[model samples]
Target: MRVLIVEDHEELAHTVAAGLRREGMAVDVALDGHTGLERASVNDYDVVVLDRDLPGLHGDEVCGRLAAGDRPARVLMLTAAGTIDDRVSGLGIGADDYLPKPFAFAELVARIRALARRTRPALPPVLVHGGLRLDPSTRVATRDGHRLMLSPKEFAVLELLLSARGAVVSAEQLLERGWDEFADPFTQTVKVTVSRLRRKLGDPPLIETVPQAGYRI
Candidate 1:
């Protein structure tokens, strides 16, 4: 999944971004709310982790604008305050969920994944096709009962392709969702990842490439 973190705490923002990236998510960090909004405007994200207190623009206003805008990214508001009133106000503004400071990293990851599920049509928690099985929660993949060791990018590409349910997914879509903003559009990242994934899947190739189209499972 793609996530935008709008936190003024530079260290915190980068730290969280790195963690999320390790979880196989495409993450972008914005040091302030205005940059957050600008990043959100151009990129499609599954979730936005917004800090309540921000510079340039307040997180509350950012959430409000996002709620009113055309994009459909779920917002998870964060603050140092942990009170009934604080949470109610944050949700009242537009946050889909609220997290207080000093929260467990596991809970944050869980909440982000839960919010991401609401973004598009629901799919099975564990995706299965043929003899292939993938569990997002466990970050495990197996083919014909044999385990497949995949890199973060390869796993993400496979997950996205499997989630398509036989529909053609363009390279651009893969790049947008499987990679962060730093990825060059002209790069062969998607192709390379897919090629690696196919090799790992072994014989009886599952991914099909369409000339001038994209790829499908």
Candidate 2:
């Protein structure tokens, strides 16, 4: 899933971003509300981890703006205040969920995943197409019941393609959703990863390249 974390605490923001990345999630960080708003506006994010207290725009305003827009991201509001009023206000402003500060990392991950799931059409717990089956929650991929060993990148790529449900996914879309912000768009990383992933899936060549139009399952 792709997430945007809007927090002013530099260390905390980067730390959270790193953890999410290690969990095979695409993450982008904004140290202030304006940058966060700008980033969220341009990108298609499954969830926005927004800090309620922010500089240069206030988190409330940012949340309101996003909530009013069409196809806005699922907002998970974060605040130091743990009061019921605070959470209610956050939710009132269109945050889909609320997380108080000093929260457990595991809970945060779980909530993010839960929110991400709501952003798209509900799919079966195990994504199945032809002979391939991917259990996202367990991080397992099996082809004809044979477990496939895949790198994090390869796994992310495959998961995305399977989630696409045979729809074509552009290289740009793959890079944005599967890779971090630092990925060089001009580089051949997407192509390279797709090639490697295809070899592992083997057999019927399920991933089809559409000439200059990117790829589809």
Candidate 3:
């Protein structure tokens, strides 16, 4: 999943972003609330990790603005203030879930996943197109009942394609969702990952290239 992290704490934000990246999720960080709001306005993210106490805009205002905006993504409010009133107020402003600070990384990951699942259109956890089956939670891909091992990047690319199913996914879209903003489009990284995934899948070319467009499953 693609996520935006809005936190002023540099070290904590970096640690959370790194951990999420290791879990096969694309992440972007904003050090202050103003930048975070700006980033959220333009980017299409599946989830946003927002801090309640912010510099320019308080986390509640941020959530309210996002709710009122053209595109509203799932918000998981994070705060050092762990109180019943705080949680209620955060949710009242439009947060999907409220997570307190000093949380376990595992719990954070689980909550993010839950928030994504809740916001996404109802669909089976096991996504399938043709002979391929992908479990997003487990990061596992299987073809004809046989499990296929994939590197982290490979798994991410495959997940993007499979989630879109028959719809074409542009290289830009893949880059936005499967990789961080720093990824270079001209590096052929997506292509290399796709090639590796194809080799492991061993099928009648489940992925189809959309000439001048991108790739589709």
Candidate 4:
């Protein structure tokens, strides 16, 4: 999933970003609230890890604006304050979840995944279509009972295509959902990834590309 972290603590933010990346998540960091708001506005994020104490803009204001927007990313507010009142206040501003500072890394990851699940329609744990089967929790993919060694991007692209249930998935949509903010929009990265994915999936050409449209299975 793609996530945005808005934190004033640079070290903590980078640490979290690295850990999340290692966990197969696309992450972006914003040092303060203003940058966070700007980044959040530009991208389609599944979750936002926002710090309550910010420099440029208050966290509450940031949360409020996002919550009121047309398509708001799920907000997970973070605060050092662990009081009931504190969480209540954060939720008052429309945060989907609240995490007090000094939280467990595992819990944070779990919460983020849970929130991301809410963004998309309910999907089965194992996504299967014909000979293709993918177990997301295990990060495993198989075609006709044979294993496929897919890179992170390739795996993400295939999972997205499979999840579309044969509906056309545009190149732009794949770029947004499969890559992080650092990905250059003008780059041919998406095309390259899809090409690699098609090779990996192999014979009979399962993926169909429609000219000027997109890809479908």
Candidate 5:
């Protein structure tokens, strides 16, 4: 999943971004609300980790604007205020969920994933096709009861393909979702990752390449 974190605390923002990246999510950081809104406008994110108190424009306005916008990205508001009123206000302003500051990193990750899942029609918590199974939460994949070792990138690519449920996923879409903004658009990273994933999937070749289109499973 792709996420945009709008938090003024540079250290915390980057730390959260790194953790989310390790979880196989493409993440972008914005130090203030204006930049956050701009980034959100430019990218198709699955979720936005918005800080409730921002420097300019304020997080409330950002959340309200995003709620009014056409983009479907879910919003998970964050704040140092932990009162029930604070959470209710955050949700009233359009947040899908709220997390107070000094929260557990694991809870933040889980909340982000949960919000991302709600962005579209819900899928099974554990993805499966035939004898192949992938537990995203555990970062484990198995085929016919045999485990498959996969790199982070390879796992991300496979997840996207499987999430599509057999729809053709273009290379550009894969790169946009699997990689962050810094990725080189002209590179063959997607091709290489897909190739490695196919090799690891083994036997009965699951991923299919559509000429000039992209890949599917």
Candidate 6:
């Protein structure tokens, strides 16, 4: 999943971004609310980690604007104020969930996962197709009990295809979900990565190319 983190706290933001990246999620960071809103508006993010108090615009405004905008990404409001009123106000303003400061990383991850589950119609974390099994959490792909090594981007593409299970996924959909906003969709990067992934997967041809469409597992 791709996530946009809008937080002014440098250390905390880096920590959260790093943790999410380790979990095999693509993450982008914005230090202020305006940039956060802009990034959230342009990108296809699974979730947005927005701070309630921001420099350019308040988190509530950001959430409201996102909900009113063309592309609405799920918002997870974060603030130092831990009160029932604060949580209610954040949610009332269109935030999907609220997480107070100094919170446990596990809980934060869980909340993000929950929001992601609700926003994106994906298969369970573990996706299976015949003898192929993919563990998203561990970023591991196994075929017939043998572990497969894959690059981050390659793994992401395979995960997207496997999640769809046999249905064809369009290139636009793969670019939106498998890669970040800056990725060049028109380029051959996706094809190259898929080629490499196929080589790694070896026989049986797990990934089925859909010509102009995309790929299916």
RMSD to native, candidate 2 = 1.6
Work out the TM-score per prediction.
Answer: 0.96, 0.93, 0.92, 0.90, 0.97, 0.86
Backbone clashes counted, model 3: 0
RMSD of each: 1.2, 1.6, 1.7, 1.9, 1.0, 2.3
**Candidate 4 lDDT by residue in tens digits, 2-106:** 789999999999999998887777899999999999999989888999999897799999999999996648999999999999999999999999999999998
Per residue, candidate 5 scores C-alpha lDDT tens digits across 8-85 of 999999999999999988999999999999989988899999999999789999999999999989999999999999
State the local distance difference test value for candidate 2: 0.88
Q: Assess candidate 1 and give its lDDT.
A: 0.92
| Candidate 6: tens digits of C-alpha lDDT, residues 1-217 | 7889999998889899999877777889999899998888778888899999987788889999998886747889999999999899889998889999889988888788778767346447678888888886667899899999988888888887876768998878877887766778798887788899999998989888888887898
Steric clash pairs (candidate 6): none
Lowest summed lDDT across 10 adjacent residues in model 5 is found at: 115-124
lDDT of 4: 0.88
Q: Model 2: how far is 191 from its true place, Å?
A: 0.5
- Give the winner by TM-score: 4 or 5: 5
**How far does residue 120 in candidate 5 sit from its true spot (Å)?**
2.5
> What is the lDDT, from 0 to 100, of the residue 209 in candidate 3?
87
Q: What tens-digit string does per-residue lDDT give for candidate 2 at 92-200? A: 9999999999999988998887787674576566788988998766678999999999988898899888888888899999998888678898989999999999999
Q: Which 10 residues in a row give candidate 1 its minimum summed lDDT?
A: 116-125
54: Cα error in model 2, Å:
1.1
Residue-level error in angstroms, candidate 6, position 162: 2.2
Best by TM-score: 5
